[model samples]
Target: MDISKYNFYVGTSRGTLLFNSDKPNNIQSAKSEEISEVTSLNFGRNENELLIGYDNGCVNIFDIIERKYIKTPELQGEGRVVGIGYVNKSIVIGKHDGIINVWNGKRNNYFDTHLDEKGTLDTLVCNENRHGVIGTGGEFNDLKLWDIETQQCIFKAKSLGHDMLNLPIPTSVRGITFFPEDNYLSVCATKEGHVLLYDDRAQRRPVVKFLEKKASYTTIACAYRERQCLAGTTRGYMQVMDMKAGKCLRTFTNFTGSITSIVCDPLEPYVITTCLDRHLRIHNLETKELLHKVYMKQNLTKVLVKSIVKDEPVEDTSEKEKVDEEYEEIFENMETVVSSKKLKKQKRHDEDVTDKPRRKKKKKLKQAEG
Candidate 1:
């Protein structure tokens, strides 16, 4: 809530967890009683208020300062909510059914729009340079731009023409972000592990593409540098690249699974990432060094970090060392735990195969031949 302090909120399977960001690494977590997982998280028009979307089709607003939920607004449709963004005092809900609901307030004032009807919505971004302009991307669909006030689709990217060797380009978008300096310029990550920059005003095709064989980017952050940005990939790595030069500057990896979401601390040179390995990591953007890491009980999907460097150091060094030792044990078990999850999934698949009926063999004909 307080922008001056170092803090953050993490969205997980059970609910949201608030990290105190203290030197000793204290955590305060809140679980939703009726929800199985938190689908989306956004800061409202007021920075102190947080809007949370649940898998059970409920939207709740919370005050970050008081660490308390304010209200639960009624939603029109019920489905798995994927992405949420706050713009112009309204909350935009991106659902798994491809429905984008724009709710103004708690009085049931909302409007609906469709994204990718066949697939789940993957990312939603509000333009910092352009008012009323928003972007949405899905699993198999291309990126789309819309004006929420007018409730109309303004732009849709076309599949790129050809590759260097005359091969067709892939258009499935994985993550998207608008350039803060220019409203017409936007960047997106494709399923092919490529980062493409699109100029909405100039042409439908991308202006530049980078990281052809690096990693499958799942999420991106835009505030790390002036002409460069950071992107989190499906292979549990993060890369910083120069958009104009189409070059990768650095890469960071601290998790064993996919990086789901990333946020850059505006006040410090830090980047926070949430991963499917049930870890939240803080790293230096320039040095690519791990500053601090926390292993939550649930897999974190999204993270909102405020600050990384505290103004004053804690007096007790033993307390900090004790917490770090505990986290080290937790971090050491992350890989084993994640592997167990994969084993469980494989076991379920094996059970499904064993559930099928097998054909019986004939006996009399074989005996006569013998």
Candidate 2:
């Protein structure tokens, strides 16, 4: 598999690290852009400009190509910025303490609001094609969709009802992401090891919910397919799920620590992941194979795949040639191999004929005596 086509950003404990997938020693000595730890990441309309949310609840606009700061909008807060995204010309930021801030560049103004004033949000995602809509959820809050323009809730998800024993199951949302192909569809992963799919047009409750045993999902990402989502657990169990069927389609293993973040390539069959084990990895979603792994030196939080300016396909034919060479090695002495097999058959025929002749001679001697 050729990974040289992708360029992505990984958020770490120190800062955000940039890497190209083609490198042999990616992120080996790559310096981070910011000093503060990155808590969230998003791309602007240009795709070249990146929006970085810091643990300090501040958002910075950075040009990934130029490797420079584009803008640092003035804001003061003391919470982790859990989400950052764009709507037309405005920047919307969601903090852990349920505070949501939106900044409009046209008016050079901003507004701030809270999600009911009390609970913390673990996941906040802006709908890409939904025209200024966003979704936010957490351990204490139910999954909700909001219209950023009016600051009103468009839909609110109801928590799971009582169990078979009549005991209410708690809601703990760990990750949330909008399906790229559908504006009304969104998926969420919870600490309770459940993945829920919601369509705001259908109902406030999830249309489908699937449970992955022994998996407390830490991160979730929507695959390029229509109704597929990839989920990663704290125990490093990763699997692709068919959200419509509510079943696991395939699983990718061999991870050592918690799966902190996941990102699927928009135009490729690759899934990029960052883990607490300090390794950035790319896996082939089609073959369930680990294509590349790079060690970053610190725990990674989030990763974003940048848009490709130009894509040049790279194929390594050396492996294919090596396999052909191995096949040739098996019968290097082709004539001798054939002769040896033939020689074994000849020996067996000689033994069979010699015994029969001996029996005939003995019978002829007995007949002459009679």
TM-score of 2: 0.77
Report every candidate's CA lDDT: 0.75, 0.80
lDDT tens digits, residues 1-370, model 2?
Answer: 5556567677777775555645646553244445778888888767778888888766777776677765566654448888888886888878777767777754433334355555578778888878989888986688888888788887889878989999978778888988878889989999988999999898888899999768899889989787899999989779899998999999888799999889987767888899989888988899988888888778888888755467677767998899889989877856663588798999999999889989999999999999
Off by over 4 Å in 2: 21-24, 28-34, 106-118, 311-370
Best by lDDT: 2
Alpha-carbon RMSD to native, per candidate: 30.0, 13.8
Q: What TM-score, computed on C-alpha atoms, does each candidate reach?
A: 0.75, 0.77
Following a full C-alpha superposition, what root-mean-square deviation does model 1 have from the true structure?
A: 30.0
